[model samples]
Target: MTILHVSAVKSWGGGENHIETLCYELKQSNPEIKNIVLCVENTLFHERLNETEIEFQTAPLAYNLDLRFSFKIIALCKNKKVDLIHIHDPSAIALTIIADKFASLPPFIFSKKTSFPIKNKKLTLYKYNYYKIKKYLCVSEETRRVTVESIKVKDKVITVYQGTSITNKSSETDFLLRKKFDIDESKKIVGLIGNHIRAKNLETFIETVNIIVNIKKRTDIIFVQIGSFTDRTEDLIAKVHELKLENFIHFIGYIPKASNFIPQFDALLMTSQSEGIPEVIFESFYHKKPVISTNVGGIPEILQDGINGLLTKKQDSAMLSEKIIHLFNNKELAEKFVTISYEKLITNFTASVMAQKTLKEYKNILNGN
Candidate 1:
């Protein structure tokens, strides 16, 4: 089977990471199934793909409705004899719909990787319900629920949890977080990995840091954020300065293989206001690190409160701070959380399992099941 994966996103984030992971796993498990990626030219996704052996092609997306991108899609589909098209983001859905207008493309398997509600609009509804889309593989159960609300055929939407690849599990890194950031060796490092986007709720991250350091007077913990810096970053930095957390917080912008740093962290912190389940949680599980996240999206599906990890309400800085401190002080509890998380990841959430389930969907779709 030949699959052409589409992603119109410009920056690298969880959705982009999912595509990379899926392709890599599919290649390893089913080599006969050819996977080709079509990403925006010169974008971060394109750059990352260039580093991998994954077969990928790029088209320019200078605007929302760039026919250049559509033309490229047409050429790829015809030349490759593509069996299916997997749309990884909403933008790609629109682009693929446009491409289909000029050419008869393969059936689409759209992956709903976020919990944001589908907008109730004419074009939006039409694009989503487009005839060619065969399956809606959601990242989490919450994502599947949100998608079914707007989808015409509820059966088309199903939850397929995205998992992390554990091919090379190691704590090896060129530099230590403490030495690189000049943090004290005695301080506990709390890591947050996500681009500086509004959905990440970085403002709440800043607020949590403030409450922990300034209000609660905790000098034993440090916050290290690793992700792409965006326009929202300036405001986040300003908030950190305003709260007098310059020394307490470190924004390590856009590190490649950021998950490699997860093993070094005392714990993983996620303050997302929304999610389809961040891949970081799975990575933390593979790294055997305790996680503390806002109870949103598919997170609660995997992270049982006080069982595998701790979950707090979105934007609740006070509660988030308390959880962080609680995890820090309770060593036995942290060990228990990590143990359960690692077992869950190995048993149910590995990339190999994700690929097998996805491959089954592909076969069912092709066999007209």
Candidate 2:
């Protein structure tokens, strides 16, 4: 089966990581399957494939309606004899619609990795319904439900949790992650990983740190955020400065395979206002680390309040601080959370398992099932 994976996202996040991992696993599982990845030029995703032998190509996609890029997509579909087109972003879906007019492209498959509702518009409906979308592989049950509510394609949607590699990831050296940041090992470290964006709700995380440090007088705890700067970056950084949290909070920019460094953290923190099934959550599980995240989107589906992890309401910095402190002080509870999450990760959310499930769906779709 020949599949063309299309993604136009410029930034690298869980969605990008999902695409890369899915493609790599697909190639490894079935070397006969001609899997090709089409990513935007100069993106973090593009740079990530440089050392790998994955069959990848690049296109300079500027907008959702770039006809030139659309033409290239059509050419790849025809020349590569692509039996399926698995897109990783909304922009790539738009390209599929534009290509539908001028070429007899293959059936499209889209992975909905976020709970954000599809916009209700004539054009939006046309883009989704007009194309031959075989299946909507949602990363979570919540995503599937939201997709059904937002679009008229209920039968086409299926919940396929984006499984992660549970195998331990080895870093290059004895990573002195805290030493480089000048953070002492004796202090408790909480880490957040994601792009500095509105959805990530990094401001709330910073505010929670501010409260933990200044209000609670817990100078022994240091909060570190690792991610790329988005449009809302200046405001987030400015908030840190205004709160006098420069020393307490460290904004460590984007680092690939961040979980390798996360073993140093006391607990993983995610203040996202939105998510599907966060890959980092699974990473923390593999590392035997607990997570404190906002109860948004599909987080609750994975993070049981007192079971695998702790969850608080969105934008609730005070409550978030409380959860953070709870994890820090309660050793038994923290260890229990880690143990339970790791068990689930091994049993269900593994890369090999995801590949088998996804490949089965692909085969079924190809067989007219």
Which tens-of-lDDT digit does each residue in 1-369 have in candidate 2? 898988888888999888767777777777887888898888888888786777888888777677877888898988888998888888888887788789888888889999999889888877766548888899988988889886565788888888886543654534566787788878888889999878898878988998898899888888888898877888888989998999888887777776677788888999999999989898888888899999988889888999889999999999999998988888899989999999998888887788788888889889988
TM-scores of the models, in the order given: 0.98, 0.97
Model 1: colliding residue pairs: none
Clashes of 1: 0
Largest lDDT belongs to which candidate? Answer: 1
Q: Which ten residues in a row have the lowest lDDT in candidate 1?
A: 168-177
Model 2 stretches astray by more than 4 angstroms: 173-175
Q: lDDT of all predictions, in order shown?
A: 0.92, 0.84
Query: Listing every candidate in turn, what is its Cα RMSD in Å to the true structure after a full C-alpha superposition?
Result: 0.9, 1.4
Model 2: colliding residue pairs: none
What is the C-alpha lDDT profile of model 1 across 64-177, one tens digit per residue?
989899889899999999999999989899989998998889899999999999999999999999988999999899999999999999999998889999995667777899
